[model samples]
Target: MKRQGGFTLIELVVVIVILGILAVTAAPRFLNLQDDARNSALDGLKGAIAGASGITYGKAAIDGVESLENQTISAGNETINIDFGYPADLAALEAVVDGLEADWSNAASGAAILFGYDGYNQRCVSYTPATGANVPAVTEVIEGCGTNF
Candidate 1:
């Protein structure tokens, strides 16, 4: 009797079934990376905003105008306008720090500046400028971070 070298049919079927199971379990994790990326981007943006707000407030305090609203101060070549020691608006913050406009869009709503990721303005960070008595409030709406509006 000649000895055949090919594997049994059952072996191929088992390999295919294992691959399918792996794909089923791993696909979702890879798919969710987009969501994770967007969320992380928003978080980084929030951190930048918070840092800028703090720095601007420090500058305002140094000028002895921390409690005053609608004040402008010069840091390097950038002119930062502040309200109650916090960057008055997104524009002011952008002056203190760059690149926000490159990837993000913002709008003013009531007492806060709403910054949306990419073009989805609804899913973003809401930055409320300082009210003299407290630090600027930085909050986010990531529930729709990776989804289309």
Candidate 2:
């Protein structure tokens, strides 16, 4: 009998089984990586927020005039103007941060998350999921201590 140009039925079945096994073994690792990424992103966000607190409260050793009217925080290239008393200031930041946090908590779960500022002269952080879901989401606003407005 002449040999077939393509794989035989048994050969195909074997290949499929091998692929399935490989997928099964790799899926967990991939999932774990996703979790790690999410976690990292969150950590970065927290750190940035912490740093922002100092800036907002004038506690940082850095020398600069801190004014809510014209003060701004930059993470990388993303810059956010801080005007806490303005009618729209808190609301706007809250909206952006809330949505992003929800997305991160749901999408990334436990991945090593990174929150940066000034991503494009805009105060926003980019959350990278373990699955490489680079969602440039807005994190919580950098709230200042004793900021009534």
Model 1, residue 112: C-alpha shift (Å) = 1.4
lDDT for 95 in candidate 1 is 86
Identify the candidate with maximal TM-score: 1
Candidate 2, residues 1-149, lDDT tens digits: the string is: 99769878999999999999999999998878754664565566655544443343342113242333444554344444443311113322333243443343221213323333211212223332112112222334222212111
Q: Which stretches of candidate 2 lie over 4 Å from their true place?
A: 1-3, 32-34, 56-149
Estimate every model's Cα lDDT from 0 to 1. Answer: 0.75, 0.39
TM-score of each: 0.82, 0.35
Residues 26-145, candidate 1, lDDT per residue (tens digit)?
999999887678777878888888887788778888999888778999999888888888888778877875797776777677887777755553357778777765655454554443
- Among residues 3 or more apart in sequence or in different chains, the pairs in candidate 1 whose N, CA or C atoms overlap within 3 Å are none
TM match of model 2 to true structure:
0.35
